[model samples]
Target chain A: MAHKSAGRSALARVLAVLETFDQDNSALTVSRISKRSGLPVPTVYRIVAELLEMGLLERGSDRRLHVGVRLWEIASRAPRALGLREAAMPFMEDLHAATRQHTQLYVLEGCDALVIERLSTRSAVTNVTQVGDRQPLHATTGGLVLLAHASLHMQDSFLSAPMRAYTPNTPTDPAELRRILANIRTRGYVVCDGYITPDALGVGTPVYSPSGDVIAALSVVVPRDGAQPMTHVRALRLSSRGITDALGKPQVRHGPQNIRLFPFVNNEQL
Target chain B: MAHKSAGRSALARVLAVLETFDQDNSALTVSRISKRSGLPVPTVYRIVAELLEMGLLERGSDRRLHVGVRLWEIASRAPRALGLREAAMPFMEDLHAATRQHTQLYVLEGCDALVIERLSTRSAVTNVTQVGDRQPLHATTGGLVLLAHASLHMQDSFLSAPMRAYTPNTPTDPAELRRILANIRTRGYVVCDGYITPDALGVGTPVYSPSGDVIAALSVVVPRDGAQPMTHVRALRLSSRGITDALGKPQVRHGPQNIRLFPFVNNEQL
Candidate 1:
């Protein structure tokens, strides 16, 4: 039962209404929703009424609309987000505790890196990454790691598209990025200094699935000053391996005592 | 915009299809979904096609359908879930680290407690409370704290319902529960020893919003043996206060350094 008369499906129009609510513009009026979704006021009102009835959208005490807890409950069943985040949380916690910086986990979604979870120390750095936010696959450390391991077709398309340099140090040259991706494959990690932000340094490593595919990237962002790259790289590689192991053994869940952690490798000394 | 042709609205049908996939049945085939959601096969197929196109549902390599990451991204913008979570994570982390047990946050929704987030130590204690799962208001520690602070009408309805005793210790009598709930309000915390599980004890405290309404509960589940209920209560109250402060000062954000933690009350001595 698509909405053929409306020129778009009913689900599409409803999604348009939902899409208008984001991190910044979470609460909005009906007119604002109509403006944002490009739908008529009556259409927006009808959709909003149905959504409110279904508990997908809630009107706040201020009378502005917000995404409801019911929608969050429904979306929490997403295996990709819930499973990976659960598997990676302990390792991420360890990394965050040790470094007192930002520990982020990202998955490759449609040529962009989608942050699934992040644990940040309040005063650690100036990184702007937030959970559920997407960043370009070429300019961020996690993005580069994920893109390097992504399908060759995706890599080709990404390289062909015009890229933005968030900072002067961001490598925009496709040839140079290809070399960096190749090096990341060889080194098992990547260290990007001032790639996304001028004052931040991020080290990224790939996390694997049970079938040996790189499912996600685990990264740590620290301030540029006193940024010991190898130390962060070693910690990230170690944690990513832990996540990979956890992902492979779904039966052996959550107990730190059950999983055997890998010994620390002093790659710099080596 | 509503799906008037079908018996149920289009959005309702879509929600029904989405509801078929929960934590246990995350991956399913169309036939199974049709069986579970009770929709016609062709109707389910058409809806699934639309959902797949919109990236709300995904087909895995095994040919089973699963909830997509795009849906999770949309749900993550849910202010009720995300804002509370971001405000509570650090405090939960602190509690989890100090106690090495299950630290959970819950909000009262429709006479039940909806677990929004939970931090568990692998071997701390056995807690069946997964994030997004619901528990009865009269049975769980977090539930009682939330129910106690909820509207008087909600409390009355919950008390009138036929309750099941999960264990011998679960409070089922309306009079007894009312007294316990009243005690909880007076004490500003709850200690449920063997209420749900005989081997576990839980302590819960209320978290306030900027407007000072009881928005959520911060709780810990620990092994009943040697369970210092007072110790757990103190930690929960402290963290609940921290969460309240964070919720109030939205601009101050994540720096633990900025928030002044309250001194331990030593309530036992008092």
Candidate 2:
């Protein structure tokens, strides 16, 4: 069941309802959902009634609907998301402790860099990346790392597309970006100084899966001034290797560890 | 929109299919979904087909249907789950750094202790609480903290119900548990040594919302031997106060910081 491109299916309509809730637009009335989803008001109510029944959608005392804990609970089991996040967490934590900057993990999805997990202290540089928020593959250090490891076909397609420049330092020329991607692959990491923001520097390394494929990117964001890029990269590579090792051996699963943690391994060993 | 306890609606059937997959059962076949959800094989096939189209479910190379990244993307926006997780992360990281043990943030959901976020290194205690997993109310320190703060009617109902005993230390008698909850209320923290596992000790404190209602609990798990349970509780209370202060200020909502970290505030200040 690839898709029902012939017409909008009933399930698509339900998904549209869920789509209306996001980081900014979390709580909404039925009419707002109808407006956002482009479905009729009556249809919104009917679907929301079902979602509410399933506890997938909750109505607050204020009578606005929200994405429910049940939905988040079910979604937490997605292997591509939480599984990767789980494998990356301890390493990310260690990297954060060492660098005292922002540490982020990413996977390539739909030509955009999807942030799987991010850790930052309040003192981190002014970086505007959030987990699950997609960034342009050309603008982010993690994105370039993934693009470097991505299929040639995907690379070619990305190179042919126009690049958006957020700042003077963002690499906008496709040919130059292709060369940067090549350099990233050769070095196993990339340092994008002021790519997203003027005051930020991003250093990213490759994270491998058990099958030895570069499945994700682990990146750190530090302040541009006096930033030791090589030092950060070295620390990041250490964590990346740890995550890779954890993935190589099937990670022992335990917790509600954010409700539990993987006590099977030791901190010093990593 | 409460619930139709009568005949199943189409959305109800869809929810049944989604609910069949959890922390343990991530992948399932059409037949398995049918067996667990109690829907017909053909019906399961039909719904799975639609779910696949919507990218709510994905088929592996092995062809086992699993929860989709798209669904997780949608659910990640859940304010209660990720919102709290985001607000709690930096402090949890600080606590984890200080204790180097398991750090968890939990919200009370229904009658169970729902884990919203957890962080730990490889050498923490043996506890099986995941971000989305639920634990018995009377068995976990976080659960008891929330129970202590719950409404009187809710407290009475829980106290009047049968409590399961997982270990010799897990409190089963409502009267004894009630006294323990009272102590928790008086001291503003709870320490449960060997409550779930003989080797693990759990220390917990309350996390309040902006309105001062107990919305969640911040907890830590350490090795039972040389645990210094009171010491852990003291550290937990510090982070709990930080979390509560951050929450009390209408927690600056930004990113997946973990469970509930106030990104707007700096860590040095905390």
Candidate 3:
């Protein structure tokens, strides 16, 4: 739901109008946007007109409004998204080719793992994750890897909240998840068996920035039946190292003491 | 340069500040933004502050400003961008694997071809185009194919302009380019030898939308020496057809009469 407040700033209104369009509601009529955005019809009209003129929005053939390519062109330059994506792409391709499964790149955003890029095969195991889709931190292997390297405060708060169990194997209990996270940090990789889907198993490893901080997670999803998690983990580590090298940073062998509880505390606001 | 006219609306000002960021200038200081945007320091500061609060802009560790992940997250939902990309990615990956070269997707933006998606191997032939980079319509295979399907008015205006010749083989003559475009439409593909750069050959084909209009171009670039352009063309046509089917559009074999000069007139403004 949009932040429905009186006297919201013009910028806030525009953001709300833009936010009204998402994966499920990619296109909407003016009235639908006004209803979803909680902005008045006239206000929505003015904002839409301005946005359309600026090429931030486009009118579809059916007269519904969709986000414009111009906006995407501008936003594609964001270093936080495409910059990281560019660095990880080649390695991800290699992993995808080797595994013939779903290879994904993720970053922590709020309490969710935001998938930025995913390479999927036509016959790969079912993966609910799509690019730009967010999954709960406790329900996905990529999220667990990121959470393990997250700050203590974030982990504590996250573990304090009640999390949904996507499958019976999903780790939702705070104490058990804490142990699992600690294990992931020690192993430097995670193998999640049917945490998100009963038929899928995911192997995840951290991708470090030039500053030696965990900036993202690289993972591959394979069929849980007859899955060899360690084999996937080995492949993941190799690709993760490749991504780290591509980022102009050499892979640092982290001893137990070098593993910080808050490697990305400054990188993301928890 | 950003529009710096006085009394611009708040939307325009916000856009101006965002526009100041490009691939070349991803990170900027407040003063640099002010100078590039041509806005007063106080105004720029206020706008920047609001944007920072909304998470549209982020401060890097170096204290310089960068485009934030939140902005990219929202913009990633643009159907005009990721939607098309999602449909084209599998086919693009297949093309990349088969050719071990640069596989790209382009759409006509203004008088240029805007690359929305590109897949490249680490040791592939040199490709000047990057994702999000714009190439002159007459200088690259993707651009040429898109230009061929453009409306008559756009083609006329584009040919009337002084075009840049990236290489000696680049087509700069209006009459020659017109003939090339006609050949492309008739053959449903084009082979560009050393057009954008020496020692590279690009083969491009049109990707049709569900409406039967040319929505984008799919292309692959390989080394020129002993390159088989027909083989690449066949691969590109297959991938383009796959993308068209993925878009829920059954591929229609276009006769010369069915190929309208203004097929995309309603699709794009120019």
Candidate 4:
């Protein structure tokens, strides 16, 4: 369907080569990319060569290929990711400082919660959430907050799907999950004890927009051992409100702020 | 030269479309993309269709096209940007808190210092630096530190080029810049007063890797009004050391921490 519409398998081929490099497979050999992408070796080689020239891919001294910095520079302008991140950063900093844990801001993408921003310290617990990473809607506290506030159609579709059980405590049963979601929408926050991992407790609340729509989720993952999850719930709710207030402001810039380091001709272009 | 090499100029054409979206032109119409990229409208349609299918480009509610979340997700794997960002975030947070100003982490990309991470509050003085944004080597304090600690070959090549004079005070004379670079290397930090923007002062220091290579720079931009550039120097130097120490650590996870919100088979895959 994708091929017939665009009529350019070249784009597909390029995307296939790119799909080979994920978190674990960041650095890959040409042969490995060929095998993983299921593209012929020669095609992969040719595509890699083109990507290298375009600065979309780079080769390391170890002869491993990885995604290029140029690609990141372009993608950094993504409104949904970088835009939300720029808005939430200050509130997130306050939340992180107060909680001293793995604090994160997430946006609903597809059937998962895609983390747009995250703040962690060296001595923090084993909360592994990272920016640009996604978590299933049923397993994360932030995900549940998003799910609860999502449109009824989205909520129904998500609940009906067979959800993955992240941990034994992960509520996969649709009926049980529905009850949890409903509770979250009412309380405006949710605390999950050992939902994703046993050692961490997640507290999450929704970040709203000027139109009163739930635009994002704010949360903290703290160690479960002697941890007061309610304490973080208060902070998350407060920070989420701060983020909403910041977003509601008209003067707040979106995406990357246009910095004018050089006043030669045009500042916008640079 | 690029057109001749790709054989399939489709990659170059696709990149041209992607390049049409930037800080100012974050959202563009199909025709705008065609005009900006100088590609035929039909050719743009074909490329855009393919890009939309691959989730590399998204169409906004306003019917404008933008770089998509998927692109950001893929590019987030970039080691030079995201990896360094991961290691420096905590130290950056501490620096921001201590100074209560715009704290930033930058890496030398080409002849510019590319901002990898930044921390700021709403009331902080006008800090125009943004994540994934670039500041010219001669204009920014961070850029000067990177240039100072850079390899001799790089330094020589950069100095020989005819550089832009950002402001009247911007050091355009290569000999003057050479002296500044030398001073930075000797003093361990730099403070640029009214170099980039007239209202801001930037203080910077180098972050070193375990192998003693200068991997990144740490800096802050505070208002020039009663701005004690020397006061921020200590904070910046200490944070630079903290970032260097963090990077020097063997276990500092590259990119975003490998968040395991879902344990169904492979959390890394999700």
Candidate 5:
């Protein structure tokens, strides 16, 4: 028998404290954390104390709290993020060195594309994407590639809603987006010009797992006027395939199998 | 009034569950988690359900649970880690490109040297260190550098203990360690040969904040019998200075001061 009306388990409240932290508010006073998480001040204080003792949260000289290095260490050991990033790094490095632009690796999390890792050159074009940042499925090249290979249910849900346009060139109409997704599936890659910003062009391709399922997307963002975008796309595809091959290796296969497959119909190409 | 003993608080139990997953065990079943955390099976089940719903953890097809991407995203945005990481990346990249070896940035946490970031070449010498791994204070070059410039109480407490000898060359005698620390302070860099591992050499220098307090250590590890370790020491010193200059920039300064000066006498060379 489960109690449905506990109003939120102690676990949820603890997670709530962690969730209160974000990019803009990395450090917070206990009162602020309480306000942000909607946890009672005393409860927040007690939870914060326990977290501090456990090394999940740390306090700085300012008396404000921040995420602890121990938490990062534990999370880094997680097979999903670090495992994929390790397998993808050498390839990502090659792509970054060759293009001398922004190279990113993303995995689909629910309805959003979560950027797991990114490398950018000093003179690269500015983009809103950052490691650990989320982008809409219809507005980013990596997101589009992932969305193109995503399940039919996900596609229907994404297409049913009004898509937010980041720039004038972004395909907001569900019909046009549906066509683009079809083309991505057929062409094995997706390239969008000024989709997120007028000055940037994004190109991406899918990465596959051993079972030939599209597991992630690798993309490069370059200035719209920069060198031919096709070159980056070709490099990304080659690198993505290399990563897939790496994933197929037996050593990495022993890790978690939570690799979510993009629900594309034809899995042969991947 | 505080609850005398609210079953260790649901938050504490949840943290214990997360804490049980580390580098050695990244994925576990509910039974394993219960056993490792000493929590009852029924309680573990209920909390894991809430955690899965909140995307704090995910269950793989094999029915094993692992840390979730959502947790990583939330932790990644913390300014202490990401902000420092962002500021240090360019310099770290430069050091890595130039040396083609293992380059690391670390800060003092508790009694260990906590690596905040690291970059390594595939062919570089084998190092047990990872991005968030912690190494003993006296046995690591980075730790030694941080210790040399740490508060008198910290330095004494660390040196006073019987240091764990990781390798035959590791400095264990407190008097000898103090002498070596004095040399590091005078030379502005440290060359630790066969300290952490017999096959490796670690070189390190202190990174200072705007107020000229040591906040971190920058180091490089290379093969013991390879080229002169002094070269890496020079590079580390230069990179440390570069990071200190970056930290001194007015645009980056925010919040309360975290600078704490070392209690030892300032040697002019450093």
Candidate 6:
């Protein structure tokens, strides 16, 4: 059934139309979407029309296509992102208030670290991360923390790939990266100085679910030359614990689920 | 074509399925989704399978399904929501910090106020609103403000219906509501006390796009029994203006376009 089409699923094609609109290209003509998605112009038009009718896609006053609020409304209802964010918010806010830096929450999405939420200050160090953005497992503090607790197979797959280097200080070699991951596992935290950008350093800790599975990573980005990043590690760990504790609460079960699904595993796997 | 099948398109059915998930019911069994969307269980399953394969939905640990991270990612990339939120954030942050209350940014979405972003303290007054949640035009300060500045046709159509009243203080009579909207239009801000919830008060102001259209509404929610809600009206107006000014900047143009598709319009013929 899977091999029926090297041509992607209709759903995938539909997603392709949505994926075409991003931070850089927010609005696109049907031709642009067609070219980007590699779908025929007629197909793009039909799909776009269907999506618009479904309120999954919308057209702007400029006659260009964009994502629809209905999509966001549906996505926002997702328990994993919004629920976890809701539970973590009070704690994240406490941490943010204390540090007044960049506070972020991330979860493992495939092999990459997906930032679910982030709060930044103008006076904080510069970082390339944004909410709903992704970063590699080897380069980010949050990614490394998640990678540290990930399944051995996931770790091996990640380390086997040639890690992209954002800064000279990033660990690209599999052996060295393996050692770093081990260290993170042992220390219960990961700190990367200038791994992503030259001017910033990040420290991250894991957030566990009720089952003690490391479901997400919490991190703080600070200027590389500023106060010891280690000092903030305690706060990060505390905030992570608070979030995890909140997740374990019955009230949180009533909150939205922010689960990320990987086809390779079913519910029983967790 | 429009009259076929209860005026519902295939796309509309798909949207209905998506819309069934909200903050209250983020994860749903296939049966629940089918029931909520009024689609047959078989059709819901088929479409949901496609949506799952497309990364728009994910199965949770409970074996139920929720909105997928990919959906949020795609929606976040929509220029209207993400773009407007990005430009509005710094200003929103400033407003939140200043007011120490719930500061929200909402755009008119299909005759309702759809909150795109919000920042609040944990101890702040309780609000029924959430990011991606929708409020009726007559119930929220933001909604009222947006409705006041809306086209005459929109105003007439909105007031023509029997509006749902959340609290006794909520104006159910069209004449009284009309006066309130007119006052908002004249005063340039709205101080709504116990309109939605008896314990909260809302202060709202309009946000304009570069073209001078009232593209969004900015509001602050505070405890009803605390200081007068009008005290924050000026601050809310300032922040709204600040967001409008920031949105007008040249670099802020390319944002997710889907967020800009406001759903509510006056269909006088209806």
Backbone N/Cα/C clashes per model: 0, 27, 0, 1, 1, 17
The better candidate by DockQ, 3 or 5, is 3
* Candidate 6 Cα deviation (angstroms), residue A270: 7.9
DockQ of each: 0.33, 0.36, 0.33, 0.34, 0.28, 0.36
Name model 5 segments beyond 4 Å from true. Answer: A1-6, A250-270, B1-7, B160-162, B248-270
* Cα deviation of A227, candidate 4, in Å: 4.6
Error (Å) of candidate 2 at residue B216 is 0.6
- What are the runs in model 6 whose C-alpha is more than 4 Å off? A1-8, A250-270, B1-13, B250-270
Ranking by lDDT: 3, 1, 2, 4, 6, 5
The TM-score each candidate achieves on chain A is 0.89, 0.89, 0.90, 0.86, 0.89, 0.89
- The lDDT of each candidate is 0.80, 0.78, 0.82, 0.77, 0.75, 0.76
Task: Encode model 4's per-residue lDDT on B119-182: one tens digit a residue.
Answer: 8877887666777788889988889998998888888888999987665677878999999999
Model 4 docking category:
acceptable
Which residue segments of model 1 deviate by more than 4 Å? Answer: A1-5, A252-270, B1-6, B252-270
lDDT of 6 by residue, B4-115 (tens): 2256655566677788887667778999988787787887888899888766788977788888777787787655566677778887878887778888888777878888
After superposing candidate 3 on the true structure, give the runs of residues whose Cα lies further than 4 Å from its correct spot: A1-5, A249-266, B1-5, B249-266
What TM-score should be assigned to candidate 4?
0.86
What does candidate 5's lDDT look like per residue over B43-85, in tens digits? Answer: 7888888888887787765578888767887777654455566
Taking chain B only, the TM-score of every model is 0.89, 0.88, 0.90, 0.85, 0.85, 0.86
Better of 1 and 2 by lDDT: 1
Clashing pairs for predicted structure model 3, backbone only: none
Q: What's the iRMSD of model 1? A: 10.3
* Model 5 chain B poorest ten-residue lDDT run: B261-270
Better of 3 and 4 by DockQ: 4
